[model samples]
Target chain A: MAVFKPATSNLLHIEVINAIINAIVSGELKPGDHIIEQHIAQEMQISRAPVREAIRELAAQDIIQFIPRKGAYVAPLDPRNIEGIYLLRSYLEGLAARLAAPRLTETDLNEMYLLNYQMGEASLKNNVDTFINLDLQFHDFICQHCEHSQLKKMIDGVQLQTKLFMNMSKWHLAAHSELHREMNAHEPILEALRARNQEEAEMKMREHIVMAGNRLLEYLVDNKSSKNSKKEDTETVKN
Target chain B: MAVFKPATSNLLHIEVINAIINAIVSGELKPGDHIIEQHIAQEMQISRAPVREAIRELAAQDIIQFIPRKGAYVAPLDPRNIEGIYLLRSYLEGLAARLAAPRLTETDLNEMYLLNYQMGEASLKNNVDTFINLDLQFHDFICQHCEHSQLKKMIDGVQLQTKLFMNMSKWHLAAHSELHREMNAHEPILEALRARNQEEAEMKMREHIVMAGNRLLEYLVDNKSSKNSKKEDTETVKN
Candidate 1:
C-alpha cells in the first residue's frame, strides 16, 4: 500500500478521493490492487467513514470495483478501456482545438507555447513528472478556452483516467525517446492555432492524440506476454 | 408544481432523483424553475431529507443549479449548452456505430430497422411521444452493442439531457414536417450498418446527429427574439 498524507481540509471524503486518485496517477497504486478502507483511514489518521465514502465515490466513477464478499479493488484495466479513453479524448480535444482556434487571444497562444516549450525541457531532463504536468496544462489550456463547459468537464475526467492507467503500465518509463517526439508534435497544433486555422488545428490535434494512443497500445502489446507470465509473481511480491 | 408519485422503494433519495428527472423529461418541469424540496417531499409523501439529497445529486450532475440563499432551480437553457451536448453526442454515436458495424448481429440490425420504421409510423400518426421514444431506442440499440462500455455510458447521460431540454422546449410541437425528415435520417445509418461498412456507418451516424442538432439550433434561433420578449410573462404565468 502507498503511504498517504492527509490532504487539504475540504470535505474529508473529497480529500480522500484526491489522495487515492493522486496515488494511482503517480504509479504508487496499480490496477487490481486491493484497497482496504481501514488501512487508508489509519494512514491518513482519519476515520474509516470518510475513507469508505471516498471508495464508494471512486467506485461510482468506475475507478474501483467491488466484488461480492471480496471488497473493493482498483478497477482492472483492459486495453480497450484505454483505447476508448484516448479515442474519446481525441475527438473532444480536437473539437476543443477547433473551437479555441478562432477564439484564441495572443496571450492564450503564448501560454500554450510556453507550456509546450516547458514540456520539451522536462523531457530533455528526463523529468517524467514535470513533463506529464506540463503536458496536461498544454492540453487543458486549449480546452479551457474552448468555450464549452460540458466539453471541458468531460475532458478533465477522461484525461485524469488516461494518466492513471498510463502510469499504471509505466507508460512514461517505456518511452523516453517517444516523449521528445510527442512534445515536438505540439508545434503543428501551436502553428495552426497561431494562424487561426480551425480545420488544421482540429485535424492536427486529433492526429496528435491518436498517435499517442497508438504508441501506448504498441507498448502494452509488446510487453503483455512477459507481463502476463510474471503477473502472479509480481502480485505476490508487490502486495 | 408537477405531481410525482412515490417511486420504487429503493433508496428514497434515488427515487427522488428519478421523479425529478422524469418530471423534467416530461416537460412538467421547465428550465429556470425553482425546486422546492418541501413541496417535493409533500408530493411524494416522503421526508424532506431525501428530497434535499436528491437536489444535491442533481446539482452535482448539472441538472440543477444553486444560487446561494436562493435555493435550487432547474438549470437554465443556453444555446451553446444544447449545441455542446449534441456535438459531443454526434461524435460519440458516430464512434459507436463504427465499432458496432462488424460486431452487430442479424438480430441487432433487424431490431434497429424495426425501431426506425416504428418511429416513422409514430410520426405519421402524429404521436410525438411514441416517435420520441422510438427515436431513443433506435440510437440506443446501435450504441448498446458498440462493444464499448465507456462510450455507452457517455451517450446515455448525454441522451437523457438532450431529451430533457428538447422536451422543455416542446421540440416536437414546432416541427411536424421535420419529424418525418429526421425519421428518414436514420435510414442511411441503418443501411451502412447492414452493409457492415464501418467508415460509412460512422459518417452517416455523425451526419444524422449533426442534422438533428442543426435543426434544433435553427428552431431555437428563430424563436429566440419572441421568446426573450415573452420570457418574463412565461415565467410569471408558468410558476
Candidate 2:
C-alpha cells in the first residue's frame, strides 16, 4: 500500500490514478481491497485532495467501486462486463480497421506482418508477455491509422479495461492452444488489409475479437463450474 | 467570466467542469477564449486546486486546448472532427438500438412514438429548443434500455461532443426543412423497434444519425462558402 513514491507530476491526480491502477495490475491491490485515500496520499507524500480526485475518477471508470458507507474498493472483475467491453472493442476496432485500410501503406502492412510473425514466435516459445504486448501493438498500429482521434480514444479506453482483466487472468492465454488460436486470428485481418478491402478487413477484425472474447468466456464458465464441483466434493467429504 | 457561484459539491472538479461547459454552451465562453484558472477559482469562491484539476480534465477531453507558454483556451470546433464524432455516434447508437430492440416493450414503443409525435409538433411550431431536448430524450430513452452500461457511457460521451457543437450552431437545426427531416428520421427507427427487428432497427438508427450528420455537414459547408463569398465581395468593392 505504501509502494508509491513522492509525486512531482503536474497532474497529480492522473499520476495517482495510474499508480493505483499499476498497483492493482501488479497484484499489490486485489479486488475488494479498500482504497484509503489518506493512506495513498501519505504514502505518496502528497496531500489527500489529489488522491480523493483519483478515487473519484477511478470509480467513474468502473475500475474502482464505492460500496455506500464502506468506502472505495478495487472493483471486482465481472465476466459479463468484460464481454461487453470486448464487444465494444470489436465494433470500434472493426471501424478502425475499415478506416485504416485505405490509409495504411505498404510499409505499414509490412510492419504489421512483422509484428504478427514475432507474435507467432513468442507464442511458440510460451512468451505470453511478449506475445500479449505485440498483439496490442498490432491492433494499435491499425487504430493509429484510423484518422479519427475520438474513435481511437474510445478504443484505448476499452482496451485498458481488457488489459486489466487479462493481467488478472494471464493463465487463460498461457495455454498453447489458446496462444496458437490467438496468433492465427490475425491472419485474415492482415490479408484483408493487404488487399485494401475495407469491408472484409472490418469483418475479419470483428470476428477475431468476438472469437477471443468467446474463448475467455468459455474459460470463465468452465472455471466456475469446476470450482462449484470442488466445493460440492468438499461438502461431501465433510459429511 | 464571474458567472459561477461558490461550489459546495464534494466533487468540486466535476462542478467546475460542468460550470465551464455550461458557460461555453450558453455562448458566454466562445471558442478560442482563454480559460483563466485563477479567475474561475475566484469567481467560484473555491480554491484554485479544483479549478486546475478541472482544466486538466477538460484538456484531456479535448474541450480545452493548451498552447505551450500560453495556457489553455476553449477548443475550436472542426467540422471534420465533428463528422468523425457523428460517425462514431452512428455506429454506437446503432449498437444501442440493436441491443435495446429486443428488450423494449410495447409500452416503450408507444412512448417513443409519442415523443416523435411531439417532436413533429415542436418542429412545426418552430420550437427548436423543445425539439432539440425531445430529440435527445428520444435517443436517450432507447439507450437507457440497451442493458450495456459501458456502451451507454460511450454513447453519452459522444453525444456530449455533438451537444457542444449543436449549441454553437443552433441555426442549422432551426431551419424548417431541417427540423422536419430530423423529426421524420425517427419514424423508421420506431417502426423497426416496434417490430423487434434488430437489424432493421440498427440500420435505421444508423441511417438516421448519418442523415443528421450529413445535414449538419451541408450547413457547415454552405456557411463557410457563404462567408468566403462575402469576404470576396468586400475585397472586390475595396478594389
Best by lDDT: 2
Candidate 2, residues B58-164, lDDT tens digits: the string is 76566778664578898777787777878899999999999999999888888999999999999888788888889899999999999998788778767766777
**What CA RMSD would you report for each candidate?**
3.8, 6.1
Best by DockQ: 1
Docking level for model 2: acceptable
Error of 1 at B79 (Å): 2.0
Evaluated with TM-score, which candidate comes out highest? 2
lDDT of 1 by residue, A98-193 (tens): 989999999988888899889889778777778777877888899999988767766776787777755654554545455666668899999999
Check candidate 1 and list the clashing pairs: none
Q: Candidate 2 chain A — worst ten consecutive residues by lDDT sum?
A: A230-239
lDDT of 1 at A110: 86
Query: Which parts of model 2 are misplaced by more than 4 Å?
Result: A6-14, A53-60, A66-71, A175-177, A226-239, B7-11, B56-60, B66-72, B175-177, B228-239
lDDT of 2 at B217: 82
What does candidate 1's lDDT look like per residue over B17-52, in tens digits? 889998887667778788988878878988887787
DockQ for candidate 1, C-alpha atoms? 0.39
Label model 1 with its docking quality class: acceptable
